[model samples]
Target: MTLYQLHAKQRLPISKQEAWDFLSDPKNLKVITPDHMGFHILSGADRNMYQGQIIQYIVKPFPMVSTKWVTEITHVKDGGYFVDEQRFGPYALWHHKHFIKEIPGGVEMEDIVDYKLPMGFLGDLVHPFMVKKQLQKIFKYREAKLIELFGKMEKEENYLVLRKI
Candidate 1:
């Protein structure tokens, strides 16, 4: 099977700790995702994101249909980075790493994910090219969603965790 990698980066004006705390909370995902995507936590916040924590989610890419995914946090660093691997989902394998660094200007957030879809050759034939556009759309929505939330909560020393897009 071929491995797929996705890289995304963002610069936020917020403090390191603030960004870390916000991103560290798994429940906070709904807050930063677009409403149209219909993102929701299938499992409660019992496992807020510790090593071996399995979190479940229900996401609707469009309007009616939805997909369920379960992921486990494999590793975590206090304020540096964390990794999540898909335990059960549509993909053959999914390993996602989120890295954060404190910069002079602000905090830099990076996302590095390695994933492989199901159906081996069939997945390659149909998805590799089409999936890129879909992912871009999702991330764009996330970027805008972050801008709105951070903008609303903007204040001194409270950097809102990202640049206003």
Candidate 2:
């Protein structure tokens, strides 16, 4: 099976605690995500993030297509990093890790997502034109939303890279 990985990094002019507080709260995900995605938490998001926590949501990844996504917060290290894996979602496999570190004047946040689509060959064929592009747009929107919420670090450019693994 072909597994795709997405790596994104951004530096924010905020304290580690500040970044942790905002990111650790599940509700803030909607704030950072694009509105057109129709992302909404169904349950398991009333409290702060913790290991074993399960969050359910509805997302419209494509026009006229809505799906339920359930993810488990598999790992969490206070103020450092956390991992969330798909329990029930569109992808055949989804493993995402979020990392935060204190930088010179602020905090740097990084995300690594490894996933595989379903339908085998059919999935692979559509990935380049559909799935990959969609993911790129989503992350781009996220990057812009984050910049709007918390000012960016001076002269530091955020980046996102997707590759096969």
Candidate 3:
């Protein structure tokens, strides 16, 4: 069982509270996610996030196969950070952390995901060619959509920066 990690950070032209409000809402996930992935939240998300919140969704991670995913929000800090873990999903283990902090111009949002596949050796073998690439593409799409929605400020070396005017 090999664990893979992915980290992504983005600077948004908004306050920490605003960033938390958006990301903490499970429904907003479809907005940032690519449409082809068929991201949809099956849980009631009309209220603010709290620990023990369980969210379900159906996603087509593969070409034609639809996979049901269930995740639980385990930890949440009002305007700072939150953690979500997979209760039942494609991955054998899925733990994601979202962090938001007030920066000079706006807010810095960071995502950290640690996941492991079900099939041990086979999963590791296919990860590089398929799983990893797919995740990268998904995250890239999300980054582009966010830039489009919030407007880009300056293109730094690695992270996308959005400044408030």
Candidate 4:
């Protein structure tokens, strides 16, 4: 199995609380996600993200085939940060951490996702390039939609953190 990481950071022209509130809401995901992927929240919105919570969704990876993903909220720290992990899905592993911090005039939002593709060695032969392309398209659309929806700041730029220890 091989792991690939993707990190995206954006500075919003709003308070930390505002940023936290938006990201914390599961329903807001559809608004920020790319339309092509067909992302939707299947459950876990009623209680509003407590530990032991599970969020389910059907992601259309291709035209006819759909992957059902069930993610468990492993960690939560009130309004500061949260982590979601894939319990049952196509990927071998998926850990996504969402962090928000209050900066001078706005909030700094960071998303760190470490995921592994399936099929041990054969996975690399077919899925790596396609998966990377799909993710890039999704995240790129998200960045543009965020700026349009949240009203951007000067620091609304994403970065790649090659190493995190």
Candidate 5:
């Protein structure tokens, strides 16, 4: 089995509390997500994020292909970090961790997602050509949306890295 990991970090000119408030709220996901993805919350996102919280959504990852995705908020540490695991989704496995910390003039948010594609070897074959690129595009859109919502840090460069583990 081939497991892929995507690591993304961005620094925004906002307070730690501000970042935590926005990131911890499940509803804000739609704001950061690309509109082209046709992402919508089906349920389990009415209140604040908590452990064992389950959120369901409908996403169109590809044209004419809509899928239901359910994820559980497995762990949450207030303003520090949180973890979400896929209960049902397109991927064979998905474990995502989000972390935020106070930086010099603002806060730095980091995301690490470890996932495995379905269909075994066939999944591996398409990773480089399709899945990887799609994920990169999503993260790029997220970064841009974040910067638009909360101003970017001056002269700071954020990064995204996707690799096999």
Candidate 6:
């Protein structure tokens, strides 16, 4: 299986603790995701994240097809980083890492995802046309949603500037 990696980063005008508090809670995912994706938490999302935490959700990744996804929070470092791996999902494999660091004016959050599709060559063939575009769209929606919620912190030349919303 060939693993595909996706990386996304954004700077927000918020504290590291605030970013951690929001991102570590699985319930907040639907808030940042696009509504058309039908992302909804089914269980284990009402509390704070912990190592070995399992979150279940129902998502309509394709039209008229509802899929059940289960992921486990395998590793977590308070206010720093966390790793989530798919236990049962559409993908053959999914390992995602979330990182947050306090930057000059706020916090910089980063996401790194490594995933592989189920049908091997067939999946690879469709990836560029389908999966890759879908993932990119998801992350783009997430970035805009985050900026809407916390405003944006941008580096202007030699300094970081916090844009007021």
Higher-TM-score candidate among 1 and 2?
Answer: 2
Query: RMSDs, each prediction?
Result: 5.9, 0.6, 5.3, 2.2, 0.6, 6.0
List model 3 lDDT by residue over 54-117, tens digit each.
8889998978878889988999999999999999989998898888888877777788888888
Local distance difference test, each candidate: 0.73, 0.95, 0.81, 0.80, 0.95, 0.84
What clash count goes with each model?
A: 2, 0, 0, 0, 0, 0
Task: Give me the overall lDDT of model 3.
Answer: 0.81
lDDT value, residue 15 of candidate 5: 96
Candidate 6 RMSD to the real structure: 6.0
- Stretches > 4 Å off in candidate 4: 160-165
TM-score for each of the candidates: 0.83, 0.98, 0.91, 0.90, 0.98, 0.92
Candidate 4, 1-165: lDDT as tens digits = 667888888777888878778888877878987777788778887666677889899888766768899999899888899999999998898899999988887888888999887987786665546777777777778778878988878755555442222
1-165: candidate 6 lDDT, tens digit per residue: 677888777888899999999998888999988888899999999799999899999998877888999999999999999999999989999889999988889988878888889998998888887888788788888888988898876762212111111
**How much lDDT does candidate 6 score?**
0.84
Question: Which residue pairs in model 5 clash with each other?
Answer: none
- Find the 10 residues in a row with the least total lDDT in model 2: 149-158
Model 4 worst lDDT run, 10 consecutive residues: 156-165
lDDT score for residue 63 of model 1? 65
